[model samples]
Target: MLRERVAETIYVFTSSRYLEVAAGLIMTPQGCVVVDTLPFPSESRQMYEFARRNCPAGIRWVVNTHFHADHIYGNYLFEGIPIIAHEETRAMLERVGEQALEEAKQETPELREVRLRLPDITYRGRAAIRLADYNIELIHAPGHSSDCTMVYIEEEKILFAGDAVLPVPYIVGGDLNQMLATLQKVQSLNLESIVQGHGGVLLRGEIPETLEAAINYLKKVRSFVHNAVSKGASERELLAWDVEKAGLSRVPLGGMAQELHRANLLYLYRSFQKERLRRAG
Candidate 1:
């Protein structure tokens, strides 16, 4: 389920999961620039085919949004293309990528033979690539992971937000405050459409509303945990806080809502403790 469309010189490859999540290919007279390889090798191959069929020219630039397995696991599919990523992403890939590869191999033994490749070019803060027709800006948005970046095509008013702007919980290990701030930064962009890492594309006007919902959700979780902690509730007691109170019980987050909620609470509690200690100091 991939949707392909040409917006000026850029080709948008949107996923079918409610038309959420998308990768982009910017065609230049020199070559093509690929943004965020898909999760699986098969999907990466499909993307490659999509590019070749559409552009005929080869890919020369591959920009990875982060070190998440679902985002960069398809690096192997690109073979000789020069892959790029944030410096933090490079570090994470070097440290945890092999472990993730091994885990994937256990599920799909055929992938065992393929080795994970780290990015060749890494930048901190910001980086930009000037294609023949467009300038693609990669801005670091590290709350989601110290490595997450948002890809923006200034000419097209389109943003490939990676996992940083999903409608669901800001998972992938994040700092709640930092995540909220990052969402605010994204909201400030002059975007026409936001291609999220999951869920369908969001219109520009919808950015603030969606982001506020996510932020409010996080704030509610934090408040819930704080009150429980003040009451001297044990971790078990806190964990038992009703989902209805969290306003997420009916969201159909599969069966993992409980697990995610538990994790979110733990993270919030730890963050709260850290802030309290800083104030005490």
Candidate 2:
């Protein structure tokens, strides 16, 4: 795990490599508010200790940016602090949290130490969480996942953007269009920096280009998928299509990149087919 302080009270922890997700910590006058916990129990414990030593306040709350295993599997470490997230996030976790944990365990032995904790506090739309001196706003950002949320600290002007703004955008919620909109919303914000879910933080100067890159990639994928489906192309052919020629070379299909790519193609294909059937009916 790597740690860098974005502001006096804000810090970003990321591994930048495989099997690890970035997490953020916000210190307030009252206590420390964690944006999202790391993937493993030991890493979570390390972050907890880091908070105890650096911030006067301990962990007051744990926020789930999304229900992905890399972000929420270490929730058990903060058992007392209320885990906060979007209402849909909680629901999705309730539906698939355990299965996700089981699958994660198969990939990594570290997850065996994780206890699979879900959200204690949930909300819809936008919600403002006020700490002693920090104004953290939870905004619903659905694209990468239907329940993905971004945490913005008003004072620091920094955003914990979750998986919504990774080096390569991953579209799992069947809404590549919405994903672009979500990033556009972030682009409109008065942010000094953005802490991405799996990679390095983006400074103010780098924000626009990153957002544009992601938007272009999603647009290309959506357009290509739509055209292919209209022409009755098979999913296999779509998978074999040259992603770079289609303008998705910047997106790192890392980890299970191939699986994610295959899933995205099928998702768009199925969506177009269903729309066609609905229209015909």
Candidate 3:
């Protein structure tokens, strides 16, 4: 895990072992608020230790931005802290968290110790948390997932944009249209920096370009998939659409960006195919 203090009171930890996924901590006068937990127990425990040593006030809350295993798997470490998240997040976790954990543990024995921790505090649309001088807003930004949310420190203009705003926008189990709307919503924010769910943090100067590229990539994917579907293209042919052709690089996230792009292509292709069949019926 790699740790970097993005702001005076905010720290981001990037997991070296897993897709470069990130977790964040926001220190407040009352106590530190954890944004999300790293995938592995060892890394998250390190973050927990860091908070214990640095923040004398202790941890006030744990915010699970979404229900993805990589984001919330280590929630057990926080123990008693009140967890805040979207209502649907809790529902999804309740529906499938245990089965997912069991499957994960079967694949990796290291995950055997992980326990499912559902969010105790949930809301719809949005929620606000005020600790001392910091005003934190949890905005519902569905794209990467239905329950995807972003954590904005109103005073600092820093955003912890869960998986909704990644180096390469992924909508495999998400809505492409929703992803576009969410990207537009993010573009409207006056942010000093954006801490992505994966990869490096986006500074002020890098925000606009990064967002525009993602937006453009999604648009291109939609168009390409729709056109291919209209022409009765086979799934294999649609899957052959290259990431660079959609105006995105295959380099981010240590070349995992290419794989994410492929997944997006497959998802959009199937969605367009379904739409066509519905129209024919």
Best by lDDT: 3
Candidate 3: lDDT over CA atoms? 0.92
Winner on TM-score between 2 and 3 is 3
Tens digits of per-residue lDDT, candidate 3, 1-281, equal 99999999999999998999999999998888999998899999999999989989999989999999999998999998899999999999999999999999999999999999999999899899988898899999998999998999988899999998887899999999999999999999999999999987999999999999999999888889889888988878987878888898888899998899888888888887888789889
Comparison by lDDT, 1 against 3, better one: 3
Tens digits of per-residue lDDT, candidate 1, 24-119, equal: 787777778888876656666788887777666678889999888777766877888899999999999899889888988998865665678899
Candidates arranged by lDDT, highest first? 3, 2, 1
Cand. 3 TM to true fold: 0.98
RMSD (CA, Å), each prediction: 3.3, 2.2, 0.8
User: Sorted by TM-score, highest first, which candidate order results?
Assistant: 3, 2, 1
Regions more than 4 Å wrong, model 2: 16-20, 250-262
TM-score of model 2 (CA atoms): 0.91
